[model samples]
Target: MLSGLLMIVDMQNDFVTKNGSLYFPQAEKVKPVVIDIVKDRMKREYDLIFTKDWHDPNDLEFKRFPVHCIKETYGAEIFDDLKFIIRDYSKINFVMKKRFSAFYGTNFDDILKNLSPKHVEICGVDTNICVMYTVEELKNRDYDVVIYENGVASYDEKLHEFAISQMRDVLGAKIEKWRSFNAQH
Candidate 1:
Protein backbone atom coordinates (compact mmCIF):
# COMPACT_ATOMS: atom_id res chain seq x y z
CA MET A 1 0.00 0.00 0.00
CA LEU A 2 1.15 3.52 -0.68
CA SER A 3 1.74 5.43 2.53
CA GLY A 4 3.05 8.62 1.00
CA LEU A 5 3.11 10.66 -2.17
CA LEU A 6 6.11 12.13 -3.92
CA MET A 7 4.96 15.40 -5.40
CA ILE A 8 7.22 16.60 -8.16
CA VAL A 9 6.21 20.15 -8.97
CA ASP A 10 7.07 21.79 -12.29
CA MET A 11 9.82 19.50 -13.41
CA GLN A 12 8.91 20.25 -16.99
CA ASN A 13 11.39 20.97 -19.71
CA ASP A 14 10.82 24.71 -19.55
CA PHE A 15 12.00 24.86 -15.96
CA VAL A 16 14.76 22.24 -15.80
CA THR A 17 16.48 21.99 -19.15
CA LYS A 18 18.69 24.11 -21.35
CA ASN A 19 17.27 26.11 -24.28
CA GLY A 20 13.84 26.26 -22.67
CA SER A 21 11.87 29.49 -22.79
CA LEU A 22 12.02 29.96 -19.02
CA TYR A 23 14.91 27.73 -18.10
CA PHE A 24 16.50 28.00 -14.65
CA PRO A 25 20.13 26.96 -14.80
CA GLN A 26 20.10 25.92 -11.16
CA ALA A 27 17.19 23.60 -11.84
CA GLU A 28 19.28 21.79 -14.43
CA LYS A 29 21.99 21.26 -11.87
CA VAL A 30 19.59 19.41 -9.56
CA LYS A 31 18.27 17.06 -12.22
CA PRO A 32 20.53 14.27 -11.08
CA VAL A 33 19.37 14.67 -7.52
CA VAL A 34 15.73 14.74 -8.51
CA ILE A 35 16.26 11.76 -10.77
CA ASP A 36 17.89 9.82 -7.99
CA ILE A 37 15.00 10.53 -5.66
CA VAL A 38 12.43 9.53 -8.24
CA LYS A 39 14.29 6.40 -9.20
CA ASP A 40 14.62 5.32 -5.60
CA ARG A 41 10.95 6.02 -4.95
CA MET A 42 9.96 4.10 -8.04
CA LYS A 43 11.39 1.01 -6.42
CA ARG A 44 9.06 1.47 -3.49
CA GLU A 45 5.26 1.51 -3.09
CA TYR A 46 4.66 5.24 -2.70
CA ASP A 47 2.55 7.10 -5.22
CA LEU A 48 4.25 9.67 -7.47
CA ILE A 49 2.50 12.79 -8.61
CA PHE A 50 3.85 15.20 -11.20
CA THR A 51 2.56 18.73 -11.65
CA LYS A 52 3.09 20.70 -14.83
CA ASP A 53 2.51 24.27 -15.83
CA TRP A 54 0.02 23.74 -18.59
CA HIS A 55 -0.46 27.35 -19.49
CA ASP A 56 -2.33 28.74 -22.42
CA PRO A 57 -0.49 30.59 -25.13
CA ASN A 58 -2.27 33.80 -24.21
CA ASP A 59 -2.26 33.24 -20.47
CA LEU A 60 -2.35 36.41 -18.37
CA GLU A 61 0.66 35.08 -16.45
CA PHE A 62 2.67 35.65 -19.61
CA LYS A 63 2.31 39.36 -18.85
CA ARG A 64 4.79 39.02 -16.02
CA PHE A 65 6.97 36.22 -17.33
CA PRO A 66 8.11 34.91 -20.65
CA VAL A 67 5.90 32.54 -22.59
CA HIS A 68 6.55 29.04 -21.36
CA CYS A 69 5.12 25.58 -21.03
CA ILE A 70 2.31 26.20 -23.42
CA LYS A 71 0.06 23.16 -23.40
CA GLU A 72 1.19 20.29 -25.68
CA THR A 73 4.51 22.02 -26.41
CA TYR A 74 7.89 20.48 -25.71
CA GLY A 75 8.30 22.96 -22.88
CA ALA A 76 5.16 21.65 -21.26
CA GLU A 77 6.39 18.05 -21.25
CA ILE A 78 8.42 16.42 -18.51
CA PHE A 79 12.18 16.46 -18.99
CA ASP A 80 13.23 13.74 -21.43
CA ASP A 81 15.62 12.26 -18.94
CA LEU A 82 12.83 11.29 -16.53
CA LYS A 83 10.16 10.53 -19.08
CA PHE A 84 10.72 6.79 -19.35
CA ILE A 85 10.69 6.21 -15.60
CA ILE A 86 7.03 7.15 -15.39
CA ARG A 87 6.01 3.61 -16.25
CA ASP A 88 2.95 3.14 -14.08
CA TYR A 89 0.82 5.62 -15.97
CA SER A 90 -2.37 4.48 -14.27
CA LYS A 91 -0.97 5.07 -10.80
CA ILE A 92 0.80 8.32 -11.56
CA ASN A 93 -1.37 11.42 -11.22
CA PHE A 94 -0.55 14.26 -13.55
CA VAL A 95 -1.90 17.54 -12.23
CA MET A 96 -2.09 20.41 -14.65
CA LYS A 97 -2.02 23.93 -13.33
CA LYS A 98 -2.48 27.32 -14.92
CA ARG A 99 -1.27 29.14 -11.81
CA PHE A 100 1.71 28.79 -9.51
CA SER A 101 -0.18 27.05 -6.73
CA ALA A 102 -1.29 23.61 -7.85
CA PHE A 103 -4.30 23.79 -5.56
CA TYR A 104 -5.63 26.87 -7.36
CA GLY A 105 -7.64 26.31 -10.54
CA THR A 106 -7.15 22.55 -10.36
CA ASN A 107 -8.33 19.35 -8.70
CA PHE A 108 -5.12 18.87 -6.77
CA ASP A 109 -6.73 19.21 -3.35
CA ASP A 110 -9.44 16.78 -4.24
CA ILE A 111 -6.89 14.28 -5.45
CA LEU A 112 -4.83 14.68 -2.31
CA LYS A 113 -7.86 14.14 -0.18
CA ASN A 114 -8.71 10.96 -2.01
CA LEU A 115 -5.19 9.60 -1.84
CA SER A 116 -5.02 10.40 1.85
CA PRO A 117 -1.28 10.08 1.93
CA LYS A 118 0.24 10.25 5.40
CA HIS A 119 3.18 12.23 4.12
CA VAL A 120 3.80 14.30 1.01
CA GLU A 121 7.38 14.72 -0.18
CA ILE A 122 7.67 17.74 -2.46
CA CYS A 123 10.56 18.37 -4.85
CA GLY A 124 10.96 20.43 -8.01
CA VAL A 125 11.98 23.74 -9.58
CA ASP A 126 11.58 27.40 -8.60
CA THR A 127 11.65 26.69 -4.88
CA ASN A 128 10.60 30.26 -4.07
CA ILE A 129 7.53 30.39 -6.27
CA CYS A 130 5.63 27.34 -7.40
CA VAL A 131 7.17 24.98 -4.89
CA MET A 132 6.63 27.46 -2.05
CA TYR A 133 2.95 27.96 -2.90
CA THR A 134 2.36 24.23 -3.11
CA VAL A 135 4.03 23.69 0.25
CA GLU A 136 1.85 26.38 1.82
CA GLU A 137 -1.30 24.79 0.47
CA LEU A 138 -0.30 21.30 1.56
CA LYS A 139 0.45 22.47 5.09
CA ASN A 140 -2.76 24.49 5.28
CA ARG A 141 -4.62 21.32 4.42
CA ASP A 142 -2.94 19.58 7.37
CA TYR A 143 -0.86 17.12 5.44
CA ASP A 144 2.50 15.96 6.74
CA VAL A 145 4.98 17.63 4.40
CA VAL A 146 8.65 17.01 3.77
CA ILE A 147 10.78 18.89 1.27
CA TYR A 148 13.79 17.44 -0.51
CA GLU A 149 16.21 20.32 -0.19
CA ASN A 150 18.71 19.08 -2.75
CA GLY A 151 16.00 18.10 -5.19
CA VAL A 152 14.56 21.60 -5.50
CA ALA A 153 16.13 24.73 -7.05
CA SER A 154 15.42 28.34 -7.91
CA TYR A 155 16.95 30.78 -10.31
CA ASP A 156 17.53 33.19 -7.45
CA GLU A 157 19.91 31.78 -4.86
CA LYS A 158 18.78 34.09 -2.08
CA LEU A 159 15.12 33.44 -2.69
CA HIS A 160 15.72 29.71 -2.69
CA GLU A 161 17.41 29.85 0.70
CA PHE A 162 14.68 32.08 2.10
CA ALA A 163 11.98 29.80 0.80
CA ILE A 164 13.60 26.72 2.28
CA SER A 165 13.95 28.41 5.65
CA GLN A 166 10.37 29.62 5.51
CA MET A 167 9.05 26.22 4.59
CA ARG A 168 10.89 24.73 7.53
CA ASP A 169 10.37 27.43 10.13
CA VAL A 170 7.01 28.90 9.16
CA LEU A 171 5.19 26.06 7.48
CA GLY A 172 6.43 23.31 9.80
CA ALA A 173 7.83 21.18 7.03
CA LYS A 174 10.72 18.80 7.60
CA ILE A 175 13.49 19.68 5.20
CA GLU A 176 16.04 16.99 4.44
CA LYS A 177 18.67 16.37 1.88
CA TRP A 178 17.58 13.85 -0.77
CA ARG A 179 20.22 11.34 0.22
CA SER A 180 19.22 11.23 3.86
CA PHE A 181 15.53 11.41 3.11
CA ASN A 182 15.73 8.46 0.73
CA ALA A 183 17.95 6.35 2.92
CA GLN A 184 15.46 6.11 5.77
CA HIS A 185 12.60 5.22 3.48
Candidate 2:
Protein backbone atom coordinates (compact mmCIF):
# COMPACT_ATOMS: atom_id res chain seq x y z
CA MET A 1 0.00 0.00 0.00
CA LEU A 2 1.07 3.62 -0.57
CA SER A 3 2.60 4.85 2.67
CA GLY A 4 1.48 8.44 2.44
CA LEU A 5 -1.47 10.45 1.12
CA LEU A 6 -1.45 13.78 -0.67
CA MET A 7 -4.77 15.56 -0.43
CA ILE A 8 -5.60 18.31 -2.89
CA VAL A 9 -8.70 19.80 -1.42
CA ASP A 10 -11.26 21.98 -3.14
CA MET A 11 -9.15 22.83 -6.15
CA GLN A 12 -12.26 23.20 -8.27
CA ASN A 13 -12.93 25.90 -10.86
CA ASP A 14 -15.40 27.77 -8.67
CA PHE A 15 -12.78 28.27 -5.97
CA VAL A 16 -9.58 28.65 -7.98
CA THR A 17 -10.63 30.30 -11.26
CA LYS A 18 -10.76 34.05 -11.62
CA ASN A 19 -14.24 34.01 -13.10
CA GLY A 20 -15.54 31.84 -10.30
CA SER A 21 -18.31 33.19 -8.12
CA LEU A 22 -16.47 32.45 -4.86
CA TYR A 23 -12.95 32.67 -6.19
CA PHE A 24 -10.08 33.03 -3.84
CA PRO A 25 -8.19 36.09 -5.04
CA GLN A 26 -4.75 34.64 -4.32
CA ALA A 27 -5.53 31.33 -5.96
CA GLU A 28 -3.44 32.13 -9.05
CA LYS A 29 -0.33 32.68 -6.93
CA VAL A 30 -0.69 29.29 -5.28
CA LYS A 31 -1.58 27.33 -8.41
CA PRO A 32 1.96 26.70 -9.63
CA VAL A 33 3.17 25.71 -6.19
CA VAL A 34 0.28 23.27 -5.87
CA ILE A 35 0.97 21.81 -9.29
CA ASP A 36 4.64 21.36 -8.52
CA ILE A 37 3.86 19.56 -5.26
CA VAL A 38 1.36 17.35 -7.04
CA LYS A 39 3.94 16.46 -9.68
CA ASP A 40 6.63 15.74 -7.14
CA ARG A 41 4.36 13.63 -4.96
CA MET A 42 3.12 11.71 -7.98
CA LYS A 43 6.69 10.81 -8.90
CA ARG A 44 7.19 9.51 -5.36
CA GLU A 45 4.16 7.19 -5.64
CA TYR A 46 2.12 8.78 -2.86
CA ASP A 47 -1.59 8.04 -2.97
CA LEU A 48 -3.26 11.06 -4.55
CA ILE A 49 -6.63 11.89 -3.04
CA PHE A 50 -8.63 14.88 -4.21
CA THR A 51 -11.68 16.47 -2.65
CA LYS A 52 -14.29 18.40 -4.58
CA ASP A 53 -17.04 20.63 -3.34
CA TRP A 54 -19.89 18.78 -5.01
CA HIS A 55 -23.20 20.18 -3.93
CA ASP A 56 -26.80 20.31 -5.00
CA PRO A 57 -28.06 23.69 -6.19
CA ASN A 58 -30.11 23.95 -3.02
CA ASP A 59 -27.39 22.85 -0.64
CA LEU A 60 -27.71 24.54 2.73
CA GLU A 61 -24.18 25.86 2.43
CA PHE A 62 -25.34 28.25 -0.28
CA LYS A 63 -27.20 30.21 2.38
CA ARG A 64 -23.92 31.30 3.98
CA PHE A 65 -21.75 31.50 0.87
CA PRO A 66 -22.47 32.19 -2.76
CA VAL A 67 -23.84 29.42 -4.91
CA HIS A 68 -20.94 27.58 -6.51
CA CYS A 69 -19.61 24.13 -7.21
CA ILE A 70 -23.04 22.70 -7.79
CA LYS A 71 -22.65 19.11 -8.93
CA GLU A 72 -22.00 18.56 -12.67
CA THR A 73 -21.52 22.25 -13.48
CA TYR A 74 -18.38 23.52 -15.20
CA GLY A 75 -17.63 25.48 -12.06
CA ALA A 76 -17.69 22.24 -10.09
CA GLU A 77 -15.11 20.59 -12.32
CA ILE A 78 -11.48 20.36 -11.27
CA PHE A 79 -9.48 23.40 -12.29
CA ASP A 80 -8.15 23.10 -15.84
CA ASP A 81 -4.59 23.77 -14.74
CA LEU A 82 -4.60 20.77 -12.40
CA LYS A 83 -6.64 18.47 -14.61
CA PHE A 84 -3.87 17.92 -17.14
CA ILE A 85 -1.49 16.63 -14.47
CA ILE A 86 -3.72 13.69 -13.64
CA ARG A 87 -2.09 10.84 -15.60
CA ASP A 88 -4.66 8.17 -14.76
CA TYR A 89 -8.18 9.09 -13.79
CA SER A 90 -8.79 5.61 -12.44
CA LYS A 91 -5.94 5.89 -9.97
CA ILE A 92 -7.18 9.12 -8.47
CA ASN A 93 -9.32 8.86 -5.33
CA PHE A 94 -11.98 11.55 -5.41
CA VAL A 95 -14.04 12.55 -2.39
CA MET A 96 -17.13 14.56 -3.22
CA LYS A 97 -18.16 16.72 -0.29
CA LYS A 98 -21.03 19.09 0.42
CA ARG A 99 -19.75 20.64 3.65
CA PHE A 100 -16.65 22.57 4.67
CA SER A 101 -15.00 19.47 6.06
CA ALA A 102 -14.24 16.82 3.43
CA PHE A 103 -14.78 14.08 6.02
CA TYR A 104 -18.24 15.33 6.78
CA GLY A 105 -20.95 13.26 5.16
CA THR A 106 -18.40 11.51 2.95
CA ASN A 107 -16.65 8.17 2.79
CA PHE A 108 -13.35 9.93 3.54
CA ASP A 109 -12.90 8.18 6.87
CA ASP A 110 -13.34 4.80 5.25
CA ILE A 111 -10.85 5.73 2.55
CA LEU A 112 -8.40 6.72 5.27
CA LYS A 113 -8.89 3.42 7.01
CA ASN A 114 -7.96 1.63 3.81
CA LEU A 115 -4.97 3.75 2.80
CA SER A 116 -3.67 4.31 6.36
CA PRO A 117 -0.92 6.62 5.30
CA LYS A 118 1.85 7.52 7.73
CA HIS A 119 1.09 11.17 7.11
CA VAL A 120 -1.17 13.41 5.08
CA GLU A 121 0.04 16.40 3.09
CA ILE A 122 -2.57 18.93 2.05
CA CYS A 123 -2.89 21.74 -0.50
CA GLY A 124 -5.75 23.84 -1.82
CA VAL A 125 -7.93 26.99 -1.44
CA ASP A 126 -9.76 28.76 1.40
CA THR A 127 -7.26 28.19 4.19
CA ASN A 128 -9.72 29.28 6.87
CA ILE A 129 -12.76 27.40 5.73
CA CYS A 130 -12.57 24.11 3.87
CA VAL A 131 -8.89 23.45 4.35
CA MET A 132 -8.93 24.28 8.04
CA TYR A 133 -12.02 22.25 8.76
CA THR A 134 -10.60 19.22 7.01
CA VAL A 135 -7.35 19.53 8.85
CA GLU A 136 -9.22 19.81 12.12
CA GLU A 137 -10.90 16.49 11.49
CA LEU A 138 -7.69 14.80 10.42
CA LYS A 139 -5.99 15.94 13.60
CA ASN A 140 -8.97 14.74 15.61
CA ARG A 141 -8.37 11.32 14.13
CA ASP A 142 -4.66 11.65 15.07
CA TYR A 143 -3.32 11.73 11.56
CA ASP A 144 0.04 13.43 11.16
CA VAL A 145 -0.65 16.36 8.81
CA VAL A 146 1.46 18.79 6.86
CA ILE A 147 -0.01 21.91 5.32
CA TYR A 148 1.85 23.37 2.34
CA GLU A 149 1.98 27.07 3.14
CA ASN A 150 2.51 28.22 -0.43
CA GLY A 151 0.05 25.76 -1.88
CA VAL A 152 -2.95 27.00 0.06
CA ALA A 153 -4.70 30.39 -0.12
CA SER A 154 -7.87 32.25 0.82
CA TYR A 155 -9.86 35.31 -0.14
CA ASP A 156 -9.31 36.81 3.30
CA GLU A 157 -5.70 37.35 4.31
CA LYS A 158 -6.32 37.66 8.05
CA LEU A 159 -8.42 34.54 8.21
CA HIS A 160 -5.87 32.68 6.20
CA GLU A 161 -3.07 33.61 8.56
CA PHE A 162 -5.19 32.74 11.58
CA ALA A 163 -6.07 29.38 10.16
CA ILE A 164 -2.43 28.60 9.42
CA SER A 165 -1.50 29.49 12.96
CA GLN A 166 -4.29 27.37 14.41
CA MET A 167 -3.44 24.41 12.23
CA ARG A 168 0.20 24.54 13.20
CA ASP A 169 -0.03 25.66 16.83
CA VAL A 170 -3.29 24.20 18.03
CA LEU A 171 -4.06 21.35 15.70
CA GLY A 172 -0.42 20.19 15.77
CA ALA A 173 0.03 20.17 12.00
CA LYS A 174 3.32 20.89 10.34
CA ILE A 175 3.20 24.03 8.25
CA GLU A 176 6.03 23.92 5.76
CA LYS A 177 7.05 25.40 2.46
CA TRP A 178 5.98 23.14 -0.37
CA ARG A 179 8.51 20.49 -1.44
CA SER A 180 10.72 21.18 1.54
CA PHE A 181 10.96 17.55 2.49
CA ASN A 182 12.09 14.43 0.69
CA ALA A 183 9.48 11.85 -0.27
CA GLN A 184 8.84 9.19 2.35
CA HIS A 185 8.04 5.57 1.52
RMSD in angstroms, candidate 1? 1.9
RMSD of each: 1.9, 2.5
Worst 10 residues of 1 by lDDT: 176-185
| Tens-digit per-residue lDDT, 1-185, candidate 1 | 33888999899998888899989778867888888888777777678889999998999999999999999999999999888777554568899999999999899988887888999998998899999999999999888899999999999999999999999999999999878435766
Give the TM-scores of the predictions, in the order they appear.
0.94, 0.94
Query: For model 1, what is the error of residue 133's alpha carbon versus the real structure, in angstroms, after optimal superposition?
Result: 0.3
User: Candidate 2: misplaced stretches above 4 Å?
Assistant: 180-185
Query: Given candidate 1, what's the lDDT at residue 73?
Result: 94
Q: lDDT of all predictions, in order shown?
A: 0.89, 0.90
Best by lDDT: 2
Off by over 4 Å in 1: 180-185
